[model samples]
Target: RDLCADFECEPAEFNGAANHVHLLVNLPPKVALSRLVNSLKRVSSRRMRTEFPEPARHYYRANTLWSDFSFAGSVGGTPISVLRQYIEQHNRPV
Candidate 1:
């Protein structure tokens, strides 16, 4: 939601395991990768702290939700069908 509103990026998929999450987003050509990442982390952290106080308190004592590092890559070279299939298959079972 925030991504769409702020960055004009559409989030296509989101999946997570115990400790981390994978997000697949379609960003406009004008958006910078570093700026997008920082915005996502900041907005998500703030929203999490406000919405889930108990978990946020336990996990983020310093009021920081995400780590300083993140991983991002380009999927433009690959076909969208292949990427979507890979993400779907890699998602942890509920």
Candidate 2:
């Protein structure tokens, strides 16, 4: 997918049905999160429009696919081991 290819990252986790998609990416520290998300959104939207005009035309009828705001945080104090475990268990069967 363009998201994986363009970002130089792999989708660590992917699970969704019908309307929504959830993705987890283990990206490199060098990649700016904001820049990466923005680029993915911009490029993907454009490509989708070119490939599927109908959906693209009404895609933003609700105003925008995403809001003008986003949430971000650093795991500075979290241990690598702990973080990995947390991510791994995040969406696992309960």
Candidate 3:
């Protein structure tokens, strides 16, 4: 949430499962989505590595903590409640 605020975005909902996370953020038109994602990955990766050096070293081979690709979509006419439920309930493969 703090991270989103730093990028001028509001995190409507967030959840993590398996190897991926779901985040429904409200972004301003001027904010670059790619930049925000990269910043989030960089900051979190650095902090996590500092807190858990052994796991970071053991699990990562090329010092890469995040994938290069990301998915972005508009809420459009969807209800916020529905989006929140989906994020909270959906699980991904490891």
Q: Please tell me which predicted candidate would have the highest lDDT against the true structure.
A: 3
The better candidate by lDDT, 2 or 3, is 3
| TM-score for predicted model 2 compared with the true structure | 0.56
Query: For candidate 3, lDDT tens digit of each residue in 23-89?
Result: 8889998999888888888887888789988877765657677676778777689889999989888
Q: Root-mean-square deviation of each candidate, in angstroms?
A: 2.2, 5.4, 2.3
Model 1 alpha-carbon miss at residue 1, Å = 1.9
lDDT of prediction 3: 0.81
Tens-digit lDDT track of model 1 for 1-94: 7666588889887776657777788988899989988888888889888998888777785658788889998866788777777777665622
1 or 3, greater by TM-score: 3
Worst 10 residues of 2 by lDDT: 14-23
Q: TM-score for all predictions?
A: 0.83, 0.56, 0.84
> Model 1: clashing residue pairs?
none
User: Model 1 misses residue 56 by how many Å?
Assistant: 1.1
* Consecutive 10-residue window with the lowest summed lDDT within model 3: 59-68
Cα lDDT of candidate 1 equals 0.79
